[model samples]
Target chain A: MLLIRAIVRPEKKDEVLAELSSAGFNAATMVDVVGRGKQKGIRIGGMVYDEIPKTLILMVIPDDAKETVITMILSIAKTGTGGTFGDGKIFVSPVDEVYTISKGTAGL
Target chain B: MKEIMAVVRMKKTGATKKALVAAGVAGFTAVKVMGRGNLVTDPKAIEACKEKLLSMGMDEFSESWDTEKMVTSFLDGSRFFPRRLFTILVHDDDVPRVIEAIVTANKTEYGIGDGTIFVLPVSDAVRVRTGEAGEAAIW
Candidate 1:
């Protein structure tokens, strides 16, 4: 199994989630977080906000489905004509185990 | 590349951040989380608690230490403590330094719930706007 964690702008969260759901990935956990990327945080007017609000979407999927899901999120989460600095980043890591609480069973 | 996850006490987050930066780490993400350790269910933990209480001069409470009451109260949700989960991505070689920094900042004398650190292999990383991959994407 593989764990995909995508940090995207809050405004694009729903669109990304909806697209993933339609693509048959129904299980995901989302958290509201404050972070900054390589560009640091944004500066508006004379104010500089070091931590910007973003949504973190976590999903555990089969190894084979990694590319498909990543591509889906990349396409839906990007902003503007080409892409902007805060388009967001994705991190892929390995998953050793998973368990279902109510069923008391293991595996996805 | 490797992803280093550290769950530390909430109050220690600032010290952790400074430690990471001083260790040359570029960036990381942190989220507030609520969790509990095995303290409530472990017999050894209960004994340790009793010892600490006695050392603090709470002789009555320590002498009357009721395991059943303690377990019930903890299970009722009073056991959950706030923590900060930091997700850090670093080059393979930087793993030790990052882990060292996190441990130094979070470790306490009590050492029970200081938290846990996990190192997972990262398959890949991508910079969305620039389309950079691997090391190019991370640094």
Candidate 2:
């Protein structure tokens, strides 16, 4: 399994979640977060907004679904048709083990 | 070091933290989240339910809406289960100890929503407080 963490805009969250669900990938954990990427936050009308509200969607999925899921998120989470800054980022990490608490079992 | 992230029942948060802290795991971040398992995800069935709800003049749909809302709000009430996600990073050797602590903390005899723990490899880590990176940074 692999864990895919996507940091995306708050406004784009609904779409991202919907698309994922439609694509048959509904299992995700979401948290409200604030972050900035290469843009280094945003400056509007001489005001600097250092912290931006973004939703962190986390999913522990089978390794094979990584690419498909990432692509789906990218397509739906982008700010515009061609994409723009602050659209969000996806981090993929290899999972060594998974334990199901309900079953008292490990490696599932 | 490895990043150990666990999504557990909301009620288990306190106990899980105490166990990890007692185990000497350095630090962790816990976030409240809404989630569900794949077992409850049936797209076709969910769509039909969504349409039914909408036809009844339910304002569930806002200007911006997507399928996620349908899946997450399938039951109208308690559609998505509440969970607490704990993220901990520890040295590679400490993985077993940490997992043991978490399992012990989360284990329930009845085992309804014990939660799940995931162990992932960390290529590198950097601690900003002391300008440390790699193993030292994690400390």
Candidate 3:
């Protein structure tokens, strides 16, 4: 399995969730986080907001479907017409095993 | 080292923490989250739920409440179910001990939904304060 972690703008969370659900990817965990990217956060007027509020949506999907899922997320998670910094990032990593405590089963 | 990420019932957190600490596991990050696992959210499912809601005399926001947001919330609202996510990064040799601690604390033998534990491969870890990396950074 492959774990996909995406950090996105807070406001884009719902849209991302909705799109994912429609695409038949319903299992996920959501968390609120704060971080900065290459841009080092947002600067509006004169004040620099070094820490920005972001939502992290995490899911572990089958290895074969990695590209499709990532593409879907990137397509929906973009800020505007094209794209810009702090639009957030997606990290992909391999999951060695998954155990369902209730079922006492592994490789799930 | 491996990163053990578990999404378990919120009520089980305290015991799980105590167990891990007692087992000599150094640290973990815990976050409160709403998790939806394999729940059917197809259009048909949403429509049926909307109808059920309407039948229950919840027709005030007829149009607005029929949205995907409403259906999604209905499916995974915290008011109905809230869970805790715990991510523990530990040395490879310590994996079994940590897993045992979590399972024992959770008492998963009792029933289902005790939650899931995912073992992920970690390439490296870094400790900012001391500039340590790899297994040493975790401790």
Candidate 4:
């Protein structure tokens, strides 16, 4: 199984979730977050606001489904002109194990 | 008042529990989420997800999922929260402690799984499910 993690603009979170849900890939989780890009975030109006709000979404899926999910996130989280800062980021990795507490599939 | 939020990537297991206990925030509400990183610079990918959203009768928006399992806990209540979005609201006094716990647990050396953390301020929170007030709506 693979675990997919996504950090997206706060405003786009709902669109991402609704898209993921309609794709028939339910059973995921989401939370609100705050942070800055490696550039230490952006500067606007001389406010010097260090932290920017973001939405963190996570999900678990089979290896074969990885590309589907990745494509889904990118498709929903990109800008029309190539892309820009704070556009969002998606990361994919392997899961050592997944415990099915309800189904009692602890071995998985 | 300050609001804090955290996102951590950890191998889903007892290690997460241990890290939480060590950080002294063993009592956080957790929800599951999923996705992955499209490092290939595929501009259509995020849009594809947006199209998926549009098909579902939702606004089209872009997003990204990095490579790792991310678990996030919202310590302070926040408005604009929608269904299936896990939220938590803490009093002004608890913000610092929760933030500290999240930061400590998210460190690269501590999380057992590759972890990341982030914090954000909140204005208010409302529970559409029952119209609860204050932290009740978030918790």
Best by DockQ: 3
Evaluate residue A41 in candidate 1 and report its C-alpha lDDT on the 0 to 100 scale.
Answer: 86
TM-score of chain B taken alone, every candidate = 0.75, 0.69, 0.68, 0.37
Candidate with more favorable, higher DockQ: 1 or 4: 1
Off by over 4 Å in 3: B40-81, B107-112, B126-133
**Tens digit of lDDT per residue, candidate 4, span B1-139?**
3233223343432445565566454445555433221122333423443445444543234222311111111111111222221123455666555545444433442212222222334556777889876666554
Per-residue lDDT for A1-108 in model 3, tens only? 989999988889888887787777767788888888888778899989988889998888889889888998899889778997878899998899887675656755
Q: What TM-score should be assigned to candidate 4? A: 0.45
Model 4 residue runs over 4 Å out of place are B1-139
lDDT sort, best first? 3, 2, 1, 4
Off by over 4 Å in 1: A1-108, B39-78
Error of 4 at B57 (Å): 26
Query: Each prediction's Cα lDDT score?
Result: 0.73, 0.78, 0.79, 0.52
Q: How close to the true structure is residue A50 of candidate 4, measured as C-alpha lDDT? A: 63
Per-residue lDDT tens digits of candidate 3, residues B5-47?
9988889989888998999986899989877665542555356
Q: How does candidate 3 score on lDDT?
A: 0.79
The candidate that wins on lDDT is: 3
TM-score of the first chain in candidate 2 relative to the native first chain: 0.90
Selected candidate, larger lDDT, 1 vs 2: 2
